[model samples]
Target: MTTRFFLTSAATTLLAAIACGPAHAAPDLEAAQAIVDEHSQIPTFEPPGEPFDAKACMADKKLFSVPTSSSIPFVDGIETSMEEVAEEIGFEFQQWKNQAQPTQWVQGMEFAINNGFDGIDLMAGIIPSSLGPQAAAAKAAGIQVFATHWADTTTPDDPAATHSFPIPYTRVGEIIGAWITVKTEGKANVLIIGSDDVPATTPYRKSVQATLDKLCDGGCSHTYVNVPVAEWATKIQTNVQGALIADPTINYIVPIYDSMSQFVLPALTITGKKGQVKIATFNGTPFVIDLVRQGEVEMDIGESLGWIARSTIDAEMRSLCGLDVPEDLYVPLLIFDKDNAETAGVPAGFNQGYGDEHVSGYRKLWGLE
Candidate 1:
């Protein structure tokens, strides 16, 4: 499947020219605005390939998944939707319950191998390389082992794993950076928060930095802080608060993951900088959308959780059925801001704003309709 890389080098060069100047140099507002406008519209579903008989291929197959953490609402929501899709395709899909621990991930792999499951998916943020021995053992036992929603679109697959359902993390980052540049009108002092443990975060920050460099033209300055996933609840607030206190000029806070907003909101409140510093982030998490609705968060780049589940299942099922797997998960991202945040629902609902085109789209592709 042909996937869209949101920001191209040609586009970047056309945006602005880097010049030696003090921070907050004039940015190319026209270019930044164009980037923001392009992503404002709702995205449509694109089939990864020609339709195939999914039911016939999945007749007796079973899939067992291990998520980074069952405690995370985002991970849980996707896992639940995945099971719903698996049932429609006549495959047994079970999640190996765990609390973001490598030991549990190993155990999940062992269970899948021992029980003769046809496929095992390491879902969302669980690094595959860390479980090399378990992955090798699963492969030896003829179990198809791969990661879903764990890597960026550009990341190389871990040799120990079979394949991946990569997401457009870098694209999401570029959108966030463009949003910041446009809103600040060429002057943006931003704080970027991310987790080092999550492999996808690497590309997310890289793309955001690159976009800022190109569009801001030395007009934007940013500070990056790494807070591991486990420490988000405790560390994010302190880190954000400290940064705000140290640099009162910051106008935006960009969290690579929307869930980090929970901690960020309190930091803004504690520092009395809620309105002073706007927020822009990725992930279409419901709570974050509500923040946008209430005008707390300035913008959020969202990928439908339901859409993600279907795309991931489609790829994994294709692999098990001896069909060609798409190069990347064909899921698309939508920009959510105050103007359209309420469309997701007054209080916001998981995967609610994005139309359900993918629901019917996948049904047709899999011959379920």
Candidate 2:
């Protein structure tokens, strides 16, 4: 119901051209490699020189993590991590997933403040809402507020944000874009399904365009469709099918968030364009990984759900305890394709999740091992 359009006449002129329009140019493997090599490395976090008492820090402390929609598999994974970490560290963990409407995000913060939580992790759900006042108010009340997956989104003036923010989302887009270039061998007509409601989509789209400019020089053309979170289920199907029909040359379909597979893939099947378009996405959900395993989808870039939970909790504790913690904790990003999905991507029999390196790693760093 909250699906909003980027343009008024989207139906008639859905293809709002970007600077790096999709061109079916010759494959530029060189460009793709250069990017891969340049951004291949991520930072690693180690314990501080002077240690603090984590057990003491979390003593009698309660933390609340709220996601916009816990029903979404990816969000659910993060929410699950919050709970698991809370149990390990001995703190109360809770979630407020009212899927609030309009300014409800601010309202929820007001509610949590009154509830007397020590710290709150505001997940990506309310990044675009009026959270500045709320964040400042929480800090004034001595409540540490940390946001994951949305820490550096459209909110330039982010509140008392943690430096422990990991997940380089911009880098993620570039990796996917580079993959498309190498896979298409240069000429990729890409249909990018994005959500403008989530401001983080802006940086990701820019990175994708930059990759297209480099590798898609062989005449790569692209069309971008902005679908808000509220309206994805009803609108993604119709809009994607329309885009595919509008331009049958589209060989690659990139969903900024792969969870769109829930709605987008069904649309592909309905329109009989299943094999016609390939899908590569961020957030390697188990469902999408299955698609990769079965050769239903093309590529998936995934981070460990358990690891992210650990890193997020690490950041929260550091903030609440006022320790000198590193900013931008590096979370590893793993890419999986059909060819390597079984052997190397996710490996066999491990489900779609990553190992618990961070889980144990954080334990040692906190001296809680």
Candidate 3:
């Protein structure tokens, strides 16, 4: 399935309205509005002390000729950044999807190595066990490794696990918790949902729990619901339906990612409480943005644009070019709600951008303009 990225007119209008409104709106709305305003503002960077020649970087023939493998298909922000990077530097890029499975991650890594790619952009879903070995094999093969959307298990001691960046999972959790507490007035009975098996998701869970413990003085009530990898949709629908049926008073629902929230929507419908329950999800995909606009989802923490993709490319390109590498790099985060979801650029699922203008802003930061 092809995924297009872009912001919508509705989102733009919503942002404009929020921008004109008072700063102290509803907590969720205010937080979302702040993000929109921040993104819209141009940064004033200090003038370069040394003349950094973009042409010099571009003229590096080795960088242009390097072949790289991306962990996932070019569909979302990752793909968009990769395309822009490739276009700017003229590198040959290949993409492989692990289908959100552990086994596929191993296969994809092995395939990239065998295919003689200079670097690998590992975007596999969070599977800790698979990551170490894959990073090891890639390092052993001397292939540059860049990872996105997944945590890197490689420590300083492990040569095989060298040069990786992780998304700020803990920060994301904290952001979600802060938004939820503000929205629910510190009295939230939240249903936190995500896969328990993946190590990457564990930080988010811990972060949310920690934030609740620290921030909610009265002690916010919450339940961690593990969504099984297989039959997740069916299970989420059933579980949420049962939860609502069992306790009609339940108010808050927090999904780690918005795509997973789709499954729980049916449950809310079945319980005849679709709009009554508040939802705060991560990843401001188009669907979640619509839910927020319609008041179904109270808030969301948007994944930063191009950060994941650019970090992945940076890791691989640095390795290929023999540059100094860091152990980990983290992408920034954006919080979204009804007020700002439309402004921050909604995902493709919401029929927003027409592709051309979708990721141009973020791509511009990477010198992909």
* Residue runs of model 3 more than 4 Å from their true location after superposition: 1-77, 128-135, 152-160, 345-369
What is the lDDT of every predicted structure here? Answer: 0.88, 0.71, 0.58
Cα lDDT for residue 249, candidate 3: 76
Looking at model 1, the pairs that clash are 24-219, 25-219
| Candidate 3 CA-lDDT value | 0.58
Where in model 1 is the C-alpha error above 4 Å? 1-25
Which should have the higher TM-score, number 1 or number 2? 1
lDDT of 2 by residue, 13-74 (tens): 54644443543546578878776555333324444334556787888888877676666777
lDDT tens per residue, model 3, 241-310 = 8888887778888877676677888888888988888787776566666667667777766554454454
- Model 2 TM-score (2 dp): 0.83
Candidate that beats the other on lDDT, 2 or 3, i.e. the better one: 2
Pull out the clashing pairs in model 3: 6-353, 11-342, 165-329
On lDDT, the candidate that comes out on top is 1
lDDT tens string, model 1, 206-256? 899889888989778889999988788789999999999999999999988
TM-score list, all predictions:
0.92, 0.83, 0.72
